[model samples]
Target: ALQHYHKPSIFNSDQGAQFTANAFTGTLKQAEVKISMDGRGRCYDNIFIERLWRSIKYELIYLKAFDDGNHLSQEVSTWFRWYNRQRPHQSLNNRTPDEIYYESCL
Candidate 1:
């Protein structure tokens, strides 16, 4: 799909064992994509994802007790919509994630 869309690169998750496996590394190598890993025990290495988790937990998860998977999924979707479209982020100069993402394209 990425190739079909003419996408150049992809960066991702290296914490999981699947990402560390020879098969996975070989696939990326075959595609000539750069492989970057977070430094061991360095929380700041993945600050963006960490911050996202903090925001979700504090702003949504902590505010409610979900009764089931369906309820939790609905709440999570709503939270993500607000977070991406409305919530201001300091790292983005107070712009929302969607705003920053689109701004970068220009």
Candidate 2:
């Protein structure tokens, strides 16, 4: 599955079971990706992901109530699109993340 998809040259995460598992490691290994793990008790090393979850909970999840898994799946997908392409971020100089990323690629 990973072989068919685009893979990053580096994958960084905490030392969680899923990341530490042989199955996951094997996939990264085969794809020649370097795995970087944060040190023990060092969540602040990745403050961006932390801020993202906080923003998602505060802006979207806390405000929405879903009746079913299907509804939730749909809404989360919608939320991701809005977050990436529509919502302006002060940190990105009021530009959307998609805009900044695409321009950087060009």
Top candidate when judged by TM-score against the true structure: 2
User: Which residue segments of model 2 deviate by more than 4 Å?
Assistant: 1-5
Q: Give the distance in Å from residue 70's predicted Cα in candidate 1 to where it truly belongs.
A: 2.2
User: What local distance difference test score does each model get?
Assistant: 0.82, 0.87
lDDT of 2 by residue, 1-106 (tens): 5667567889988888998999998888888999998887798987888788898888878899989999988988888999999999999999999999789878
lDDT of 2 at 54: 93
- C-alpha-based local distance difference test score of model 1: 0.82
Worst 10-residue lDDT window, candidate 1: 5-14
Q: What tens digits encode model 1's per-residue C-alpha lDDT throughout 1-106?
A: 4467544476566366887899878878888877887876677888888878997899889999999999999999998998899988887789998998788789
Candidate 2 colliding pairs, count = 0
RMSD of each: 3.1, 1.9
